[model samples]
Target: MKRLCTATLLLTMLLSSGCENRPKQYERTQELFGTFVSARIFASDEKTAEAALDAAFRRAAELEQTFSPTIADSELNAVNAAAFSQETAVSEEFSELLGLSLRYSQLSGGAFDCSIGQLIDLWDIGTEQATIPTDEELHRTIHPAAHEVISLQDRSVRFTDERVRLHFGAIAKGYIADEMKEVLQAHGIESGTLSLGGNILTLGCKNEDEPWVIGITDPFAPQEITATLEVRDLSVVTSGRYERYFEENGVTYHHILDPWTGLPSDAGLASATIISQSSVQCDALSTAVFVLGAQEGLALIEGLDGAECVLITDDGTLLQSSGMDAYHVKQVEK
Candidate 1:
């Protein structure tokens, strides 16, 4: 399954015009590697904005082609295929992502593992043929390669078991988003926002005046926002069951499988949103907190510096981390 990509638009006026010039930069869905990408970015001017957006989208597609499991030639997929059998030297991007995944896995106590690739493929959460896999099959397929199989040696890599596969679905976009933010800043484009799917990163502000206002879409009602958070120079990433799923035999199964059970995490929470300075951490922690549940997730966020979380439960309970109440969350009656 995948997270939906949407951005809160900026509506600001050039003071002299006395009218709002809130034009969208580039908003469209295109097939990148094997999946569709909903991409958007905001910039001060149209030409440079479009150029930067094109560069970002191209880079992301390049990464996907290199890392996507659907591509046999992908370095990552090949690496996964050879796991436990041979050693593979990966590109800088793969190494960086793997390193980040390892760090987060340790920090989250294995709740966030990139090694859930086998289980993800077994469930096939995004496809039409999604079903509840047999326990025997799950047990056989669900292997936490993060802890056992995958090993990072300097800039090279090796797998202890061929059965272990790695997937970067959870964190790659955020990393890309962060990179694109840097690209935009380097291009001298200040006061803009870029959203690669749901991993959003903003730099400067809208027109150098207003802080970017990002809407936290309700997991239950994505068309409607649950709250609005004012931000600048930050990234917001969310993990939820609503973005992708399928129903079979009256049972609903979404992505976001737990590493421990190889099943969809039924952590009583419907959604978890994370805000941090690094888009990579924001994206990783969104999935981490989803698996950690509400209380423990809050504790984890509290322990981490410069991290904040908002957890919305299945029963309409809103649990905010210590600093998230400043978002002015407006509770709606059911």
Candidate 2:
């Protein structure tokens, strides 16, 4: 199952001008990748905007089929089915994405893994089959480093264990969102907002006057917000236990699984948001930092260039990266 995002768009003002010199907003949304995929643009012509939006949505659907582990005939599923027994060939795009994900996994020290499908199925969070899991099957699953269990020589993949499977749920949508942005940029759309299931990416500034405003959802109150970030040409992604969970008995189990423990993360954070140029990084880091908690997570962000994060702890402590002052980040008063 896919994780949820806590970042929402707060920009509601649209400029509709009769002047041909001014750009106007055009938006088109569709349900894809198990979430609402919307593409908005500030283009001078509707024809250009519509074509770009169509291309973006089409690319998203194609990627879903390529990456979805649940799809029995998907490339990911094919790899899962064959990689255990023999070296399997993957598409060039899949190979590139897998290598990048492995780097993130290494950077996070196994906090983020693409090879997490087996444990996901065992716990089945966000599904009817979800159940509280113990450490009984933890060893049966794989949480290896980049090259520990899998070999990727010549764009072919082979898993060391039969139980090892790849799941892109934590990163695919964000990658797709980035690709969407590229497609829009190619179509001559410069300014817009993209919300692919809470992976928010802004294309340029709003008329060069202000940056796009992104509202971080309130984990305590879904209808309210906790903070807002003013950013441009950046991706903002948040991950938390606020959604995508199942309650068993009296305890709640979230979908954010810690690969090391094979259990729901106990990092003691309500949510963690990552703001960066790559929505793909924002997507994976959100889950990674949630498992990392505040201290280590903040340090990780600081070490990486062009990245900043805001973490909302379980006890209502708001933590920020050292470079947070670079942006106009505001904490919404309760």
Candidate 3:
């Protein structure tokens, strides 16, 4: 439930060890999906690089129109507006993404839910008019029973309850990033980096031998890097309470809400970073782990194959998944 902001650009690229010659790199940044989207591609010529970047941006824009819940005419908005009224026919792409989101919701035991839009609108964390809703208001408005209401049939969806609403804020960027990578590859651009706010998807590598170095943001001080991860052809997504929050009466409220309580999660976690082959999986898992808390989050990651995560607690302790130690470089002490 991260707000579309400049949170992910904190990922600074580090110099690769023993890498003297770098490929011809072309990079560009644009505003999309309510935040900054940047792409770096290494190609044979400038024209080829620019064309690939253009294609990537175009793909991102298209997906934004399809997935953004805030956009009035978006496919997701259409589904929300039609809840309990009729079965809305969606595109194959939309259906697939929705299906994937539901799968994550099931896996996390509802810790991460796409249908928490009602709760999100109640809190309105990123808006200027955001406020803390009363417990009664939350209880009355919160609708996390999406599993009971939503029915997916091929490329169509129906909600049996009018209260059900869909929001892809948790997983859209990762899916778009993965799509952008595919667009880049189709244009003969093999090596590149797609930074969609907080989701980072590396395309191949900087060179044949050098793995891209990604700096993990310190949840307490996002401007500083608490650790670095060296990865290639993988997605590194970090979900943190510090990414979007508002302070009221000397108390802080973040964007990640617990679906069960319809309030900001008090899961004692500052951030959760997930690394996996699929950006969509990593993106959903990061939020899921953050909401699941440290112990349960660690267990979830351990049980999954090809997934690893580093969970930073509010008290500054770092909890790593069983497979995370191999990619964990240096952890900074507070």
Candidate 4:
């Protein structure tokens, strides 16, 4: 649960090596998804680029309202209020996204649950309220199993458990990135990069056929880069313990909470990076693999079709899926 992104412009974040040279780059950075969303559009002229950027970010803003679990008026918040009591009607888009989230929750054995709002709030990892609670406190908070509680039919959400609540912080950024990329493409913007916080989704390749290069953030050193990769029309997303954590009595408490234990995950992974055609998949699977730990996480990525990952283990070792070699050209920093 990476929390509290700085409300600032995208300042050449450590995630990507960045683009250079010509194609009429039109860049705009705005704060969204609790982090800065930077869009770099390469179009024919200023007007085309501006229109694409405006339309793309407008869609992003709409999604921010629709998907935010904490917002009072958000659709997800509405579902949380009404789904347990009634068959709450949701948009076709919301129904579809929730369906995908449920599938992922099953696949991860609940490691990447979206229905853990209570558990997350209990931990309160990024705020002053964050503390190591007693076993009694853990016992009291009930994180409903997503499989047992949630049901969807005909663009409506229905659920059985009162404990179940929606929290889309994990998937919304990537989902919005995937969407903004579509908006850009629909506007006939050929080459661009749309980054929603740490999730970097690229449009067509840079300068025609060249691949976009992205750097992996160093988990141990948040200010630095560990490695970089070449990719085309692909997204690079990382979920790491370093994103949010606090030290207490010589023990480090991070924000990546485990749904099973109602505490932070000690899953032997400092970070997990998923490289895929789909940004949202990268988003969900990155957190999933991190919470699953190094060995099991690597195995999970290897088994999945069209997905590859680079895992940073707790001991600071780098591991990768079988096909990661195709995109992994740079050795990680020691």
Report the number of the highest-TM-score candidate: 2
Q: For residues 207-322, write the lDDT of model 1, one tens digit per residue.
A: 56676788777888977778778787788888998878888888888889888888898888899989888999999999999998998889999999999988899996778899
Error of 4 at 248 (Å): 2.8
lDDT string, candidate 4, 27-96, tens digits: 9999875688999889877888899999999999999889986567988888888898898899877887
Q: Ten residues in a row with the worst lDDT in model 4?
A: 1-10
Residues 177-258, model 2: lDDT tens digits: 8999999999988899999877898998898668898999988786788999899899999897977998878898899888
Candidate 3 on 96-149: residue-level lDDT in tens? 988998888889988888888888988898889889999898878776555656
User: Total backbone clashes of model 4?
Assistant: 0
Tell me how far the alpha carbon of residue 42 in candidate 4 is from the true structure, in angstroms, after superposition: 0.9
Question: Using alpha carbons, what is the TM-score of model 2?
Answer: 0.92
Off by over 4 Å in 1: 1-45, 325-328, 331-334
**Candidate whose lDDT is highest:** 3
TM-score per candidate, in order? 0.87, 0.92, 0.91, 0.90
Clashes by residue pair, model 3? none
Residue 178 of model 3, lDDT score:
88
**Model 1 deviation from native, Cα RMSD in Å:** 9.1
Q: Can you rank all candidates by TM-score, best first?
A: 2, 3, 4, 1
In candidate 4, list every pair of residues with a backbone clash. Answer: none
Better of 1 and 4 by lDDT: 4
lDDT of each: 0.78, 0.85, 0.87, 0.84
Write down the lDDT that model 2 would get: 0.85
